[model samples]
Target chain A: MGAMDNTPIGGDTRVAALWDGLSRVMDPELDESIVDLGFVTDVSLDAAGRVDVGFRLPTYWCSPNFAFLMVDDIARELARLPFVREVHPKLHDHMASDEVNRGAHLGLSFAETFSAFEVSGTLEDLRETFHRKAFQRRQEAVILGLRRAGWSNAAIVSADLATLDRVVLEDEEAARQKPRYRELLLARALASTPSDRAFVTLEGAPLTEVTLPAHMRALRAVRINMEANGALCRGLLDARYGEAPAPEVPAHEPDHAAHACGGGGKACCGGCARQVSAFQPTAAPDL
Target chain B: MYTTPDGEEVFIIDGHTHFWDGSPENQKNIHGKQFIDCFYGYHSSLSPKDKLWTREQFAKYSADKMYHDLFVDGPDDMAIVQSTYLKDFYKNGFNTIERNHEMAQGQPGRFIVNGAYDPRDGEEALEYIHFLKETYDVKGVKLYTAEWKGESRGWKLTDPNSYRCLELCQKLGITNVHIHKGPTIIPLDKDAFDVHDVDHVATDFQGLNFIIEHCGLPRLDDFCWIAVQETNVYGGLAVALPFIHSRPRYFAEVISELLFWVGEDKLLFGSDYAIWTPRWLVEKFWNFEIPEDIKQEHGVDLTKEAKRKILGLNAARLYNIDVEAQKVRLKNSPLAVAAE
Candidate 1:
């Protein structure tokens, strides 16, 4: 769905673009794309360029702040498409769905929607917190990948962006996160230019040989927490919607496995790619 | 009791459980239904296929079923049934102390029912704590800080009113505070599941034990940091234990960190009944081992002794249960004999 098509305004192509746009919006807490998490159930478009996106969380009691942030990001991301006129993101079956949808429609912020309770800080604060966590989680994956690929601590600590880009990571998890890590690294301005150190603390401090172990320890915690939460969310979402992935088939029966779900290429988790196949939403009709 | 492959008996105290009426007839609003649905999601998602329950059975089960799930068919020596009075969501409240105490009355010495009170209720909260102590004689209270009350969505352990309630609890000899610091949830903007409040309250209420359920997951790092410094802080494995079945690798990673930081003596096992049964969770956890890589990385081991401690000894310590004597008592209990 993400592959760019040359056919402008074609019904199928536009709907694909709509999904691609939604794919870029992440669940801030889990730091995974909403589309991949199966939180996004449907996306429909009309001839007038108005887009309606429907999404649901693993539970009715998912954090309203996160629900709001995702809904807001959906509106913002979909509106970026040149063909899109208005974006209406609907959060279904949540405790604060009405407030979130109404707030999104009126262009209100999270604080505006639920102002009764005290807000610890701006939504930006929450975003920044998750951003730092995402950066750390991605960084940990890349570093662990490098170590597994036979890189020494000294070499890893001193490695620069150019060196990182040139090196090959054999580990699947690391390889997948390499681009994501680099993107955040560049986007957050943590590192820039070819010579910039590939690894740096959230505050821009470069890791030294003596400090790498402690840094890795901190990153490991962050990674573990995020991964655990991600698994829980996926499980709950499956249970709520009765959308559990197909039962595990014998590894020898590759043909049957592929046919049961779909081609194995779409799975985010390596080897068990079919595990996430049920989560992938089919294309919606463009009316 | 879980008898090991070598014939060693391992006592298990399910540190967290719930006996509630989440049935359609009990649901006061959509929140009640959704709350139970969310629990069902957790159940179906993580439980072994054989352990899964139908939605109707999960919504409300017979007391005999809970007893069978925790003891007769399960390995738990004693279960701590926690009360969560979601009065706003349910018609008669989710699981009040009255209901739990009543449930425990039928099976003596097999249940340690915990009471709950809202600190946001101010003076009434203190009064309720006293009432809980006198009426129920509760040695522990499960704090659902995210519970909704009228206009307010949630409260914190460090709130001024909460301090007053804790002071009352401490004075009344309620030594255990099982705070629900699991996944992050509602009350927009503020982190309803934040564990930082545990830091402050744990420090102040030194006499009380703060057992953060789900090991403050999704915030394990923060919880670990706080737990490492505070001797009184603990991590309950209710929500985390089910991971042993579905995501063993992830569970190993989390347990490795907890063993390293929180230590084996401070970690407790809980099945979070109705959501997931104890039988499968206990069996899987008993046989589970942290991978060599995770063990070495954390410089820790999930040895036989550690398993024994986490499963029962740790919680037994918190509740002041004389393990040897309790074991003897349970050995002679009517239910134990009946099961045999």
Candidate 2:
């Protein structure tokens, strides 16, 4: 019974650690992890401890830049594990699968990989763009939760990181939102000024009481755009694969504030009723 | 023409439609079937439960079905048929101009046929545009930037050859340029469908109207920002319109944002027929109301007049259809008389 007899579970533990690392990698557009999206189709380890992972997207024509990011991230994550001697990341059933897989394994950048095409910016530039959008999406969810819990717009705009953190810890709803929200906020904070407000625009402008409403409105569009895209991807993935992946989380619930505005649970205002009746189906012939 | 109880008439135009043949017989490979299957996914996901069509029906629906869907069974007064030729996928080319022109022949004035050209075809493509205009008298064209040809997966509007085509459009008197800039193509680059090129082209070709189909969706924010700055740019509501049912609130948000940025006059309604029916979409949109919160927050309004413009008037203006004259013609037409 030697202490060195832990070899049986050693490979399993390393694989589990590898998965943990991959979970941190997100499909930049959807802001969801590849694992949770059911994108990782296969994973294997050889006797030599070299690892291989395979993934597929919802479509044969998913954006290559985003595809490159995911495959590169997978290899990079596996490389960090001491026990893994070599990492092979494979992309399957994609339009550019050959180039992407070869490039990823050989450690070529996106521009180098697609030299035949005109690539305007580096992969980091693309990642940064999506990161900004993700930040806004995550921030909007947290703010919407706070507003539903009866926090005034003024109070939210004035709150600092500590205050927001306390709210996330104390409020059940906010706490549920904290995992994604705090994660994004922390990532952004590391790159900003020490005196900067916790919640800021993509340009690093602090939110104030006067600017809060406008900021919320703009971010609302970004949130809606992202959510709608996420829904479309889920639908396409289900269609392609013949079975929908179980959602890792409850679907991003719609804002409660919008629903609570009227007694009918419909968003239509007083003017809408009169306008809607004007073009009722009876106005046109029945099929 | 849809007549209100108060005797007010609303002209309806299905701004974007297609007569496609995606049957296995026509498919060059799995991609042909996959292309239409992708469309079917959208159809099944967003359509009203009762409106769903079988995969068999979707694969190669007859022209009779399309005509009835747009004219008799549906609410459209005039439908604009846009051709999308994916020669790399379909053997006869998916929804070619010749096919659209053939379908339009049976209906005459009831359909407006829009042709297409691939810049990758080079100078010969420009000559083909001239031939199409003279043969079909096409007033508009559909541009698929992400179409595949030979080894090249896609081309951009900013390309030299693409500019050559635009110059030809102006020379040929093709006023309306309908550009497809949404999801999926051979190459996987995000820029394959980037709306940025639209900005450059719209600025350069000020005379021709650039109708960004699907309103450059999945990039609505970017589209809006760019559209607001360009006077020649317009928004085509194809894939976006069906959302009025399955995702009403999100639909409201999309419409509100569009109204805020693109304004009602610049927005045109498109059924994206066959993928979706005009009847249900027209009905739902006619009855859609922007939530009070959204209106206040976005500082926008979706009034009945805005609905009128979106439903038909705006497109009528773009296509140069005199609505007053068309309304009179429809009122006395056999179909309207039969309905009465």
Candidate 3:
């Protein structure tokens, strides 16, 4: 399903737009959209374009730093919309719900929200840490898909963003994964320079043939940790909500051959391409 | 204890087990309710069908039920009663040392009553550790680094006061330091259960064996990396073992990784009982063979001896339980005679 298309909030374009905006806000730990993770429980907007979004994590005690980041990101994303007069984010069933909601409404910084505790650094530090992890995870998925498609480690490490994009577009298996990987790669790369090689380390060091194997191995651990966490969160969320949990976007397209029968050119892979395109918000709001 | 068809005896020691009371009467607030409910989620999701318990029973099962689950009906030769003193959540404290000690008193030698301490209490906690040692002779301690104390959500093992507590543990001869590094500690602003803190103390106090419970899960890779470096560090397979039933492939990956990184000698089996029973976990683990792919990838074999060590012997060595001697006693004991 398209990211924007699976809005549980029906018939209201305002709420739909709000949902679409919130969909961009991901649980940094899981690297999945809050909406798709069943975290965005309710979204509404008044006639005045004042948006109030309610969301919950898989558990009451999900990392407060992560919870704050999501709530803060949701408010910021919604406020970016020209129509949104004011944004109020409500976090329900969380340990720090009151603090989070109050802080978000008041536009309090994460440091200001929980001043009692000793926060080592700013929320950005935490975000960047997860961002680097998410980048590695997404990058690993693409690499795994490319490897399965018979690309050598040398070919993968040597390929630039443009080359990688072409490779993804040309291969049916890679094409199915392109949009999400491309979006994450762009997001991470754009921070330095869009022209910079996409498959660099968090420190912006480009991978060499020698480094690529070790890099992939290290990233595989990160991917497994994140994927296992995502699975546990989904299970916990399912138990908490007891509703049919939202179908997860497969972490990896393990069955590359099954999707390979679809023609390789971008045009023939319309179905998967459309799903990818849905994630690219027109506003291009900063995460 | 279980005997395989090959007539090899496998002594089972549930290295991590709890007797918690999350019943509404004991629950101080919604967090208490949420805490046990979260456990129930894991229980229902991972436990085999026949082994699963109702939410109500799981909330607060009886002492009799715990005994039946771990000793009478289950495969545990001896179980470590890991005390989790969540005073902030439960009225008297959820799964306090006192409750575990009381439960274990009925069946002596079947349990090792591990106590807990909050280093945040500082000197008072040091004294309390002495008190716990003198009263229960607690050979080990279950440290909840993420436990909330008043305004503070959690404290780290590397904290100044924590060092003092570790010193006391060394002084008091509490060698087995089982640190709880699983999900959801209060004051989530920090990574409360970060295994990094354990690394600090593990280095500082070489005399104390730090058994990281749940194997520092969700951060298993991190735990594995640390475990390899620290000879004194061990992995307690409480939450990790239950995955053997529900997610065997993932379970293989976890076990394979542990085998590769932590090695069989340092890994300990734990049921986290009441949430999960020892019966199925022990049985499934005995039957579980590392898939050829995983075995090949990690280049580690999950031999029967390895399973034997993980199930009990590793923990036995840590706690100084003589498995051979205990097995001999069990062989002649009335329980074995009655079973025969």
Candidate 4:
């Protein structure tokens, strides 16, 4: 119907089969299942059991790092489902630095790194082709920028693409980080989302909690810590946006370890704004 | 060939246009408008020979003389703009305009002039824009290649090169990006000049306004689509229409298409005139088939009234011109002493 229609309604046999598998994948940052978080916006089940699943992140042009990771996680998780044959985690719109909007597209169309299928010879060629294809895109970005600036190809051909490449990345980062303000903002956010005692304990819960007779008392104390931090974060925007204390036995507290981002990296518990600029803008404004 | 219906002298307001007349030969001995501290200058590809449309020449030139005025009917009001590119090409910027202003303002609702600012000129652009707004009663701005494409993209807007230009524009509340775009009258695929290039800086300065030049044909798809996608961005339409009708046509298309898609009211008409689309060429565009939804949204007829709005009312509004109530100001106020 519409571009955004994505509900699993009536007679969807394939989605019905793999629904449980899809629901299990979590958005590493938010420990809850992605489906529960409404991340799985659309699900399609084919006659051959080919499943295509699409979802959106909170923001358009979200980080490619986690986006790719999220896509891969779904494919891997669904591969284990009993009747599932082929699974494709389609992340409709994502942010990638190189091309216009083709990071995952390149990843899937070329690398096939997100798939559970044995890599095909065609996939291998496509991956190599992506790297080659990138050369043309690079040329396009550089040439287009120069031509607009009044430079002819003959004039800029001798110019190094490396310089253009650097300019592109540098220029982009400068825009995103609000070079004039992010550090100040980061400092402000850090001061706000400081974690609580319970969140840390809950994160460190024993593996046995899934089915064992482990330290339920110590774990529940952690839950109390979580409630307090939850109140603080809910009470204040800072807790959600600010620097969450560390995840470890932080004489400090880590925000929510469940979904603060990065895989198993203790640093992730730091919070979203804590992300070091993937491409830190180095241009200092001329004050 | 077309008369303003029964010689009623048509309702036309060139909401956006530019001027660059050198200090007059007749006023040679007397002190001239060029001596003012806020003198203006711009980098333009058009040579001096092309820019010498005298105030007298401009005042008398029938907008219909140019072979391009057949598209749209004229508006009841007229607004003018400065050429961010052509200032230095002819004479000093403010000096050129002072004379043109003297000649152009004689017609009651026929003209509204904007100022010019080159971001590379830095604080000077801001300083002058401020002065033009308060002192000269300049209604908007004329941003050329160096202003938007230059500071925002090339030098990187993050550098304060263009940010301050836009910051000051936004702070003063101006939204005219008399911006130039397209296959650089040169050659190269530099993404810096691409139509989407502005998205980088534009995202940062959300409130500051724009009127993308050449109707953003360099990347018409993105430029037009962005109008729908990005509500803050408005595209400017004008220029030698006999040769560049595609520009206004595309401008209307982008405005109409975006109306349906992104569904926002953010299109403004700019006749990068005098050098480009003197009234004649623009008149041809007055009749370009505007979409019904757009006409309804703007609350004007499907044709003439919509064209009038496009030619003047739209920019007048974006540039903060109150079409109706503005007529009541004191006779001594700077703008009142001149014209609406």
In each prediction, how many residue pairs overlap at the backbone (N, C-alpha, C within less than 3 A)?
A: 0, 1, 0, 53
> What are the per-residue Cα lDDT tens digits for candidate 2 across B16-96?
999999889999987887788888887877677689899999988777788788878788999999999998899998899
Kindly report which residue stretches of model 4 are placed more than 4 angstroms away from their true locations once superposed: A1-287, B1-11, B21-76, B85-100, B104-110, B147-158, B182-192, B240-264, B275-283, B286-308, B325-340
Candidate 3 lDDT score at position A213: 70
Which of 1 and 3 is ahead in lDDT? 1
DockQ preference between candidates 1 and 2, better one: 1
Top lDDT prediction, candidate number: 1
Better of 1 and 4 by DockQ: 1
DockQ of each: 0.43, 0.23, 0.27, 0.01
True contacts kept of 1: 0.65
Relative to the true structure, how large is the alpha-carbon lDDT of every model?
0.83, 0.75, 0.75, 0.41
**Candidate closest to the true structure, highest TM-score:** 1
Q: What's candidate 3's i-RMS value?
A: 6.8
Model 2: CA > 4 A from native: A1-19, A42-54, A111-122, A143-194, A244-287, B3-9, B330-340
lDDT of 2 by residue, A1-287 (tens): 24433233365576678777777778887676677666777666665666777788878778877889899989888888887888888888776788998898788888788887655557676677788887877777777778868888777776676676566444443454556776777677632343345567777677888898878777866766665566567556666776632122111235523321121223222111111111111111111
**Top model by DockQ, which number?**
1
How large is the i-RMS for each model, in angstroms?
A: 5.6, 6.1, 6.8, 26.8
| Model 4, residue A139: C-alpha shift (Å) | 20
Report the Cα lDDT for candidate 3.
0.75
How would you encode candidate 4's per-residue C-alpha lDDT over B48-116 as one tens digit per residue?
223334345542234333212212232324456453333322234322446555645544444555666
Q: Which tens-of-lDDT digit does each residue in B1-340 have in candidate 1?
A: 9988789999999999999999999999888888888888888877777777888999998788888888888898999999998999999998999998888887899999998998888898888898899898999999888878887778888889999999988999999999998763455567755689899999998899999999889799989999999999999998888877666666777899999889999999998997888888877888887766567779999999999999999999999999999999987886833332
Order the numbered candidates by lDDT, best leading. Answer: 1, 2, 3, 4
The worst-scoring run of ten residues by lDDT in candidate 4 chain A lies at A194-203
